[model samples]
Target: MTSITKRKTFLILTSLVSAIAILLLSLKPDTAIMDDQTLYEKLNNGNTIYYLVVGDSIGRGAGAESRRDSWYAQLERLIKKRYGADMQGQHISQSGATAFEGLYKLKNTELIYPADIIFLVFGENDRKYMEPEEFAKHYELLVREAKVRAPKAEIITFIESPLAVQEFANQIQAVSSHYGATAIDMRKAYRQSGAEVKSLNRDQVHPNGKGYELYAKTILQTLDEFPNRKAPSTKEALYVQEDAPLHVTTSIETQQGFLYKEPYWTTGKKGSSIRYKVQGNTIGAIIKRNPNGGMVDVFIDRRYYRTINTNWPLVKERYIIIAAGIESGSHQIEFITNDHGHRFNGLDEKPFQLAGVISATINSKGTAE
Candidate 1:
């Protein structure tokens, strides 16, 4: 009698446990369906105007407490009210994605096809790690993919913040221009309106609701200004600035990274170096070729890595090298000039200027740009 009773109790407990497991499994959120359902619903709706946003934290509506308070949502509202268009929106963004990471997501993802408009906002997170040239290459890749995935869509890119590194914004604009997409410089628009930078900012990086509203308004205005035409080209040049977050040997100078300015670097001897300590899976730099340019040795952790020959005929900014697919953590990079010589363009013997240095956590391959 005891054995029979015990067996019945054990069977009852197993059934209960299985029931709970099934319930938990049913309750688990389905990520693929949650965001995609709205997209599919709108795609099937004949009266809907679809907009897709690909970006970082700001695109994900970080500072806004509610989804409706986010800038993209607000922008959709304005368009619906003003033009009487039925608006639908989707944002595919993670908190800390750089342009390369965003592109990676796009390559491996599936979204609604043939969107009416696409917004690409990134680079705030990128500037902390990637150099301008690296940023531009990845940005271009993202744009190219957007164009392919949504052929009928007009792509628009927005500047994240005025306080962000200026070169990164310019790089975004340049990428947009290259792809014939629209580029909206929100920072400049905010300044021209005489709004305090902090008034729109929720944190050191993200915008508050009020700020998001302003950003939406600005985008709408910009859209109206050029309803039928592609955005005008920025064609901004790349350069390095003095306040750039880099550590360098005493022989290096900080007078090359500014915009529309002459680049000048003077180091009297060999072993004069430029260094940057960054956290990412990639590292690179933007360098200007000079007539007097020579070989520069690259080292990681004092071990020889590679050598860069900066000698060329043209005076132009170029991405020197990118070491990608590394482990995530702090990394040390040193660029030491091995030989500096006098050139046809200049008489200086010890002068080699770098436009900028970039580092990032992008681990993808075939992203060499």
Candidate 2:
């Protein structure tokens, strides 16, 4: 071949390669919002999705007037419509469980089915239990187990909605981060929906048909926020199952108790005692404790943080408290019960939210609103 011809062919191949690279980059997300664990990388079409849905009645589709309009069904339908509705290998889960209790199920049972993906939903019931630290431990264990079980399965942990619209908004994402999984913030979707979305939600908690429709659509759209993965198709309805629940959780209705009375923190004086309750095997907390301002030694989930001078860093506790590590949710910064004796005895027995979800501009990756 002539030298000129060879040069021209080389240039053409190089240009094609560069164009392909550019296309792939454009398609991929600029940020890693989902599971940071690389397990979610796309695979061949034949690859099966043996999924396991874990959590409360939502997983069981309880609030739904019919089984058809359930969260699980909606999620499944969305998955199927996008992925050709391949249902053979998937495992439908419905354990009347919460977060802490979920640890046992995740570890002891075969529910997590060895598939390419596992959808973990909990925290609602755990909120009732109020053992956020233990729940954090269990969550970490679940992630470890999932990685061990599938090694390749992408773990997606969905944060359950709190009883009030303004609760637990920051928690789920932090916990997800500790486990090295992707944390999809549904609250953003909820917020985006505005009052109309709130109205669609049944009893201020679970979403109704309209609510579910919004939920499914927002979630599906968020899937695009993931990597260069292909979905089943846009033709698939946002979610399957028709009917849905029109009421809030009965347990939440009790309104008889709060999650923490004496939360475990790291800044208790030496020998000071910090107590936290173990609710439903997990702890659902809206921690907004800022230890950077005092000389308190932090005590939480078997860990400690030393605040030198007035600057306090978060001591290792359960899940990640959102709003710059606890500018929101339920929290209280207090001294240990026995600071004089250099021993700690946790907090009082009556639980109440010391603080609530304060609006934060830099909630994710330091992004400000």
Candidate 3:
């Protein structure tokens, strides 16, 4: 009960509290990126900036504790802040996806969302497996494909550290130059920025938290060189399902076809036919695959486009392209079940199983600024 005793206890408690606060601060990110209120304002008052990030595990944040802590996430935050826009981040980077697979994946996203800016971070998986020349060609194809899919989108090819040696980096540079895309060498950036070696994750292939922070910083700094495009005052997005009113079909059945959490999947009979009228340059489908599935033919505007096989041993959800690089106006997409020469006889009952459809309805007012 003595004054000195009470004062000593209070002092000890205050010291502990101070230490705890410092520890907590150290555990948090170095600086506050953005708050919910700021993000809401950006989504409402600002323009719409659709940002797409594609690549392998590196871009997928394999080494980071949380994916939101990745470089792309950080860059997106800064982009929204600087441009004052509703920057929608579309990340299609899978862990094991290579350049070739990435291309197909990109093709799969044509109608889901049209990106305004695209960041391609690949090459880690292709290090020892593919030749530099071949990889470069494939990289070029990917860039060209992105250009064809979203002509107005800015394509950026980002090369990461340690593994991006001279030969590999040169290939990437060649591809970027050929396609008129920008390539950022993170290794050079890290060195010039004076980041430490500890930024590398314990595995050394991927990056740690600090490394991702530096990565974001380097990318943001590079992007600063380009002028920010003036987006529309108001933006709109649309996602349509196959069974929606837009579809005019005879054979395709709209019912609970798959186990996934979806609205409806268009199950195809032997002679099933489904059609959708969409208003966009790009078109794609959300499909489900199973061992009992078959092939389906796709047609764009009455022209035979391509045939997609929906047969797989395992069941999974997939995004498939119906059409891209078409004129932005009223268009029709038709799907017909083409089940023939079946290796698995069990698929005779159920043939084509398509999940949904998606499209981003861009304004016809004017081109993206």
Best by TM-score: 1
Worst 10-residue lDDT window, candidate 1: 240-249
Candidate 1 lDDT by residue in tens digits, 1-369: 699999999999999999999887776655334333332233333246677888887888889868889998898788777665577776778665576557656655778644767889887877765567656656766777787677657788988774468888878877677767778887787777687878878877888898888889988776566444332333322221111122212222222222222453445346677665666555666566656777888877567778876766655444433464456567677777776545564444334666455655543333332
Kindly report which residue pairs in candidate 1 clash with one another. Answer: 129-359, 131-358, 239-257, 240-256, 240-257, 240-258, 241-257, 281-361
Candidate 3: tens digits of C-alpha lDDT, residues 63-100? 77676777777766876777666566778786545665
Report model 3's TM-score to 2 decimal places.
0.50
lDDT of 2 by residue, 155-206 (tens): 6777654434233434556655654456655666667767565566666466
lDDT of 3 at 316: 57
TM-score of 1: 0.52
Angstrom error at residue 88, model 2: 5.2
lDDT of 1: 0.65
Best by lDDT: 1
lDDT of each: 0.65, 0.43, 0.62
| Arranged by TM-score, best first | 1, 3, 2
Better of 2 and 3 by lDDT: 3
lDDT rank, highest first?
Answer: 1, 3, 2
lDDT of 2: 0.43
